[model samples]
Target: MGSYRWNWPILLADPYYGWIVSGFGNTCLIAVLAWSIAFPLGSAIGIARTTELRPLRLVGTIYVEVFRNIPLLAQMFLWYFVVPELLPQDWGHWVKRDMPYPQFLTSVLCLGLYTASRVAEQVRSGLEAIPRGQHHAGLAMGLTPAQVYRYVRLPVAYRIIIPSLTSDFLGVFKNSSLALTIGVLELTSQARQIEEYTFAAFEAFATATLLYCAVTGIVILAMRQVERRTRIPGTIAIGAQ
Candidate 1:
C-alpha cells in the first residue's frame, strides 16, 4: 500500500474537512450561550448562598451540591435521554416533536449548570472577601438589599474575582469537549470524522491542537485585556493596608 500523503489544499477545500471549522464555530457558540445563562444564574445562586435567609442558603447549597457533584457527561445524557421519557406522556411527545435540537439544548444546560457551580463558588468567595463595612456602608446610605448588592457588593466582588473568573472561563472552554460525547459535533468530534475518512491520525490531531490553542489563547488574551482595563491600582493596595 502507498503511504497516504497529507493534502493541505484538499483539507482546506473539502466540505467534510470544513467540518473542522464549523465544529470550532459550534463549540464557540455553545460556550457563549452557556455562559450567557450561567453568569446571571450563577450570580443569583452565589447571592443565595450568601444570603441571611436560612432557607435561601439551604436551597443554594443543594443546587450547588446537586449540579457540582454530578458528572456533566452524565447530566447531558440525563437531559437528552432520560428527561423526555420521564416527562408526562403529552409533554414528552411535545418535547420530542418541538425540540428540534435536543442534544444542543442538553449540552447548553449541562455545561451551564456545571460551570455555574464553579462560578457560584467564585462569587461566594468574592463576596466573602469584601470588607463587612461595604455592606454596612450601603445600608447606611439607605440602599435597599437589592440596591446594596447592585451598587456596592457586586462591583467590588466582580473586581476582586475577575482573575478567578478568567480561569473558570478557560476551564469551561476546554470542558466543552465533553459535549462531543453526546454528539454535539464540537472540534474534537469533527477531528474524529477527519481521522475516520482520511485515516490520518497525525494530521487530524495536529489540526485539532492548533485550533484549540488558537481559541484558548484568544480567550486568555481577552481576559487579560479586561483585567488591565478594569483594574484599580489602589484597590489591592487598600485591601492590603
Candidate 2:
C-alpha cells in the first residue's frame, strides 16, 4: 500500500474555516427564532380555527390555506426581495437600510409562517381528537372559554399532538438550510465554502452530512423523551408490542 498521508496542515489551513463556523451559528440562530415565532403563532391560529367565532375561524382558515399551499422558498424570496419594493418608496428604502440581518429575519418570518400553517392543522386535529365530554365538563365547572382552553383543551391537545409536532420541528430545522440561498450562510453554505477552498468534495460533503445527521438525531431523541414523559396515562406505550 502507498504511504498513508494525513495532512494536518491542509485541514488547519482550509480557507473557509470562518465560513464554516459562521454558517453553523447562523443556522442555529435562524432555527431557534423561527421555531419561537412559529409555535405561539401556530397555537393561536389553531385555537382560533376551533373557536366559536366564525370570523376568527375564517381568518385562521384563510391564513393556513394560503401559507400552507405556497412554497417556503417563494415565501422567503417575497419577504426579502419583493416585499420592500411593494411598500411605499420611503418605507422601502428605510427597510433596506435599517434592517440588520435582513436575510436572517426573512428566513425566520418565512419559515415561521410556513411552519405555523402546518402547526395550526396539527393543533386543530389534536384538539378534535380529544373527547367532547372534556369541554362539557369544563363548561359545567363554570370555567370561562379561555380557562377551558387553557386548563383543559390546550394541554390535552398539545399532548396528543406531540408526535406530529416533533416531526414538524424536524422539518423546520432542515428547512433552515434553505436560508443559505438568500445569503444566511448556514451549514450547507459552509460546506460549499469548504469544498470550494479545499477541492475535497467528498470530505466536505461528508462532514456536512454527518453534522446534520447528528443534529437531527439529537432532536429526535430529545423529542422521544418528551413523548414518553408527557404521554397520556394508561395509553399503550409508543413502540410497545
Candidate 3:
C-alpha cells in the first residue's frame, strides 16, 4: 500500500485528460443515439404485441424473444463482424471499408436493438396493467382503434412506465461500456488505457466509477422529477386514498 501513489493531477493534465473527455463524449453520444432508436422501436413492438392482428403480434413477440434471449456481447460481436458479411457483397464491402466509424455505428445498433427488447416488455406490461374498460370506453367514443391508442392508451401507459424506462435508459448508458470490447474507445476503455500507461489501477478505476455514479445520479434525479410530475392518482397504490 505504501508503494501506491494516487495521481489526480495526471487526469487533469493535457493529453491524458483529453482522452478521458473524448471517451466521455463518445459514451454520451452512443447512449443518446441508442435510446433514440430503442424507445420508438420498442414502443411500436409493444403496441403490436397487444393488437388484434395475429401477424403483427407474432412479429413483436418474436423480436422481443430473440433479442432479449441473446446475450448483448454476442449481439455486439454479431453486428460488428457477422452481420456485415451476411449483407450483399457491395454493402458488406461498404460497411467494412467506406463506412466511417463502423465500430461506433455497430455498437449503437447492437445496443439499441438489444435494449429495445427489454423496453418492449416494459411497455407491454404498462399497457396490460391499464384497466380493460379504458379500451372499451375509447372505442365507445367513436374513435378508430388507432386513434384510441394514440389518444388514450399510449399516453397513460407511458406515464405509468416512466420509472422503468428511466432504469432502462440508465442501463443503456452503462452498457455502452461494452463497446470498448469492439474497439469503440468509450470511457471504460479510456480508463483501461489510463491504467495501462500509468499503472494506477485504483486511480483509474476509481475515477471511472465516480464518473459513472455521477452520470447515473443525474439520470435518477431527473427521472424522479418526471415521475412525480406525471404520476397518476391511483395508478400506484399508496396506503391511503
Tens-place lDDT per residue, model 1, 1-241, is 3676766654675776779888888888888888887888888999999889999999989989998898887888888789989999999998788877877777888888888988998999999988899999999999998899899988888988887887787777778888998888998888888888877766777888898898888877777777767776666522233
lDDT per residue as tens, model 3, 1-241: 8978888888888777988889999999999999999999999999999999999999999999999888899999999989998999999999999999999999999999988998999999999988889999999999899998999999999988898899899999999999998999999999999889988778778888888999999988877777777778766622122
**Candidate 3 residue pairs in clash (backbone atoms < 3 Å):** none
Range of the 10 consecutive residues with the lowest summed lDDT in candidate 1: 232-241
User: Candidate 2 lDDT, tens digit per residue, 1-241?
Assistant: 2554434345345456666667778877888888898899999999999989999999999999999877888888888899999999999998899988788888889899899998999999989888899999999999998999999999989988887888898888889998988988798888887778676666667667877788889987887788788878877535222
RMSD of 1: 3.2
Q: Which residue pairs does candidate 1 place in steric collision?
A: none
lDDT accuracy of residue 176 in candidate 2: 97
Off by over 4 Å in 3: 237-241
Clashing pairs in 2: none
Runs off by more than 4 Å, candidate 2: 1-14, 237-241
Clashes of 3: 0
TM-score of 3: 0.96
**All models: lDDT?**
0.83, 0.84, 0.91
| TM-score of every candidate | 0.91, 0.91, 0.96
lDDT of 2: 0.84
